[model samples]
Target chain A: MLKFTCPYCGIEASETELAAGGEAHLKRYGPGSSEQDFEGYLFLRKNPKGVHLERWRHVMGCGKWFLAARHTATLEVFGTYSAQTHEPPAEIIENIRAKFPEWQA
Target chain B: MSDPRSAVGGAVYEGYVTVKDSGAHGMITLRGDHAELAEAVKAAVGSGMPTQRRIEGGLGGGAAWASPDELLLFCDYADAAGALEKARKSLEGNHFLVADVSDARAVFALEGSGIRDLLAKLCPADLSPEALPHGEFRRSHLGQVAAAFWLESEETATVICFRSVAPYVYDLLSEAVKGGPIGIF
Candidate 1:
């Protein structure tokens, strides 16, 4: 029953209308990299209990992909941003830091 | 040339709400810079570019914001090729993609006093007047299929979905209409 505000279309979409894309912001390691780096890039995930950043596709809404920062345990969303960026916006990072001072990116 | 046929062969159903196939609309999927696309769209459809998640114009011809960089431009079925040609010609020398997708989609017109209530049964979008006012287009799912809809007025809406799912969507709408209004609106 989770709901997300689509950053692209500005619609509050229910979970049923979206598709989860696992964790976000991993530095992709390609063919030239070491096996360990590639494996980590493909399989390793933070799976953090709190303050998680994930990718979501508004499949049914705007059909655009976006990144969301939220607390895993509380399901409190910090913010959503365009998927084209390499990292979360500074404002969202600042907001998360304000709420969880000890948390690190 | 063979006459174009719609997916549902122009089906119609009447219950608490009326659902009918809006046969053979010309749809163009345009992808590029919004500002540039706007000018090309005007040339193709003679309608202004739609704002985010909104549709500008009517069932005859118009543009709907499909995404930040994409638009769904629709016009008369016979004019699809001409419209696509116009858009491409206008966007020449620019990085853009335009295609005539008229046959790939199916459109349905829903009309009744219970339009909102009937749509709410299948779509997760907020169909309230304030949220989905006239001209505001919403790209959402109907039941489990990808669908988009826009309200033409308080009791009228136009829906579009993949042509492959036309029969499925028609059935869904017909069944929902038969369920009678929940009176939520």
Candidate 2:
């Protein structure tokens, strides 16, 4: 069982509590998209080791959006934020604030 | 068993709903003398909660210390009822509430790479080990299933809920795995 911290719920999700995301962010267009586009999105993929940004749609609780960055080697999640508002978590605030204080606002 | 009310989704939440008119497992709700029940449960289940929040990054099945007197135990779906009965019969009439819930709820586990990233999308809790850590359990909604989840590590979680709503819960999770937003039912 894995413990997952939901950026939206602000609580730890027991391995039984949450569903896992795809390899980072792999987005596929709806049926409206042409076959080539769908096939390209599904088959072509990249495996990142560090600072990879991905989208995870929480289907269980708050029903919100999130972006997550984690270290593939250490399993250390750098930070997560609500994608709906683009509000990053505090853990990321300090890391980015030092570089761009103006962006903090 | 493919009962009309139960689901053994590939993982815990993958197929969240299960129903059993006759339970294959036993449930023992130990109240009051929660301490004694916990001790017995410890002996029955594998062991107690893990010492470190992050162990090997693969979160294990789930054993937790809820309240001072309350501890929730998880076992094989088939073994749950028997385990509960064993505990109940062992301490008969002891000041505890032991009831067989083997048929009442469905159990599932969600584990894999990017688990935290997936959870951050559904829950509003701190799932990070540094923050929420391990050895914890919370009753919250996973798209309205009103689930109970235990965080074992960075890539594992256990989810259990009423058998009646197992399909909806499983559906929510399935939809998410496909990269769709969760919805309330």
Candidate 3:
């Protein structure tokens, strides 16, 4: 059983509490403006089998929206942070920074 | 001390237990101004205000910070006086509400590889490692009463339900341990 640390509720839940909502941070092709964009949305996935920042829901329990960074192959989850949380868990951000050194707004 | 926590499945296997208390410890409530109270508490105890994980070691005692403004502290059993005095001396007259919770609830710690599986059978909340990593806790219905699971490790968790429901939870786990199958994870 895999677990994700919910930053808000502060409980580690089994994968059962969470719902994978599709590729996290998914970018639409021109804001739902074209059919090709819709098709791309429906059929495309980088599926990079690496650490990914994706949307998760505490569906069966907390019923909250959160972001989770996970290692797909091993399912080594670092943590989960609320979507509304701006400060973001420092440890996770650091890991992200290490992976994508140039990551910036 | 094994954390004064009763492990269900009775040490039958490595981490499984046969029977155990649902809530093993007492939880106290404190209401005060966060800034002044927290600082004074820190000075008095050595460390207070649990910021991470379950069971925060206090400046003068111990507690589990259940929420941002809520904490569960105790001064009963092994170090009752020490814990109580520590809390009293530090913020006694500084406008705080302290109460004894020795019998308000009971607690239990569920350990071993089969924890996720057994809890899944008893609890509706997700106990999967991917969904809940660790250092997680929540209060919800365990069968009929309000129970909580404090994730201590990937394989171990502390369960807390009311004293009234203690027997039921204990029976539930005991049956799960003996009558149920094992969780491979």
Q: Pick the candidate with the highest lDDT.
A: 1
Task: Give the lowest summed-lDDT range of ten residues in model 1 chain A.
Answer: A1-10
lDDT tens digits by residue: candidate 1, B12-88: 99987899998888999999989788779889999998988889997688999989999999899899999999999
Q: What interface RMSD does each of the candidate structures achieve?
A: 0.9, 9.5, 4.8
Candidate 3: residue B174 lDDT (0-100) = 66
How far is B30's C-alpha from truth in model 1 (Å)? 1.1
Stretches of candidate 2 above 4 Å error? A1-105, B1-5, B8-28, B49-63, B66-69, B180-185
Compared with the true structure, model 1 gives a TM-score of: 0.96
Tens digit of lDDT per residue, candidate 3, span B103-185? Answer: 55666656666777777777767566765556555544566556666666666677766666666777777677775655644
lDDT, candidate 2, A1-100, per-residue tens: 3345566556555544455565444555778999988887878665665444555655454334567655555665556665644445677756645544
CA error at residue A1 for candidate 3, angstroms: 21
TM-score: which is higher, 1 or 3?
1
Q: Which consecutive 10 residues in model 2 chain B have the weakest lDDT in total?
A: B52-61
Model 2 TM-score is 0.48
- How big is the positional error of residue A76 in model 3, measured in Å on the Cα after superposition? 30
Candidate achieving the largest TM-score: 1
Candidate 3 residue-wise lDDT at B25: 44
Candidate with best DockQ: 1
Query: What TM-score results for chain B when candidate 3 is compared with the true chain B?
Result: 0.69
What is the DockQ ranking, best to worst? 1, 3, 2
Q: For candidate 1, lDDT tens digit of each residue in A9-45? A: 8999998999999998889899899999999998988
- What DockQ does each listed candidate score? 0.85, 0.05, 0.07
